[model samples]
Target: MLVALDGVPVGSQDGTQLGTLIPVTHLRLPPASRMEFIVTGPSENVKSAQLITQAIVTGPNGDNDTARTLATLVAREEDDDSNVSRVPNVTGPPWTPRFAGLATAAVNTTRRLYFSENAAQTQFFITVAGQTPTVFSANNPPAVVTTQGSVEDWIIENRAQENHEFHFHQIHFLVRSQDNFAINGSQPVAAIQGQMMDMIEIPYWDGNPNHPYPSVTLRMDFRGPDVGDFVYHCHILNHEDQGMMAIIRVLPQP
Candidate 1:
């Protein structure tokens, strides 16, 4: 059988320019099966699973079914559940403490200016207001120098329209908890059940119409098998590029 892709003749094997035949000994087309040609090629660098997932071929009679299957597969990947979710404006379930904020200031100082002097310059929306990037006090950074296995509380905040994933590049830290404990305290959002990732996913919750905002908190372990300058940013690429990123220097044990 003849096969062409995008109007160009395609050879099954790049090296030998051989085409796979459905009725040939190498490939047999079952009556109801939608998959078409099965091309045999060098398997040096290909993972067995990847080969199956990315396998592709073209053939006659099953064009419509092949297209349908391919479309479903592509859609599933796009909606990968592995990806962290962004909180929606439309509420879901029951949640407390919303943390949504704009990339830039949404309000300004008035006559009272109660919480801060220049509210815009002085304060930042965070999961915890006590952290340095938010409070800017002398004790903002309590762990200037910390040892491995030393318990340091890294409070991550989510002050956006959607949830964000905070990732630690160099070292994988133990996830302590989420949105439960305070920055100054030592407990977790929940019981330390099992081991988790160095990455923390902060969920956003929309507040009431009377007062609307959303945020979540995360506790992280600073100890690591590898330590150096590492990046902390929102897994969402757009937010990181827009300044939702920071750097952390995991100091050696002293």
Candidate 2:
């Protein structure tokens, strides 16, 4: 499913003190998934406006496809005092977007992270090539081991029916791209590329070969005081408890 504004889907932010809602061109949501976003009215001059768009869903078998009117957005009035803006003095490094492909290409080490639900769909996993899948075990091996200061690109793939949120501890990462088969851009993907963020949403697969699978490309930042073993997992607490989490060991920079 997709929720868009002005023909463009908007992007959502991680749950923070000060929330932000950006008017985007497009955004996608997988089945049984949810996102929180704010939409601005079209124009006060028009009194009200409407958004006419369509949504496509797969049949029970996951083969047959159908499309219908997703929603009709209506403009609303806002409080006069709610239109205040303030810019805080931020310190440290400036946030910027790191383009997709370029981030992985510049780094020699790239980790491919794949996730899927068990046959029952009640459990999930993080699997790496040539390694046993990591489940919800304290003894499970680390997903990826790397040194601090080393730049790495993690291509995360979601092979499940429901959508998932990817989150990590300590440092933030740069989102290269978030695209699956059904929906792609809600915000300026290019602009958000280099910006620092700790969480991302991965859409669900529509089971369409032409659409490809839902995935997110990210550049992990390990250049901070955070050293030693940490964890990365689905932001959804229920999913994390169901084994949708993994450890990532960051050794001191060599």
Q: In TM-score terms, which candidate is top?
A: 2
State the lDDT of candidate 1 residue by residue for 29-55, as single tens digits: 222112334445435454332222332
Model 2 residue 226 CA deviation (Å) reads 1.4
Candidate 1 wrong stretches, greater than 4 Å = 1-145, 180-193, 209-219
Sequence-dependent TM-score of model 1 = 0.37
Q: Write the per-residue lDDT of candidate 2 for residues 95-126, one digit (tens) a residue.
A: 34222233334574778887777787677786
C-alpha lDDT (0 to 100) for residue 72 of candidate 1: 20
Find the 10 residues in a row with the least total lDDT in model 1.
109-118
How many Å off is the CA of 111 in candidate 1? 32
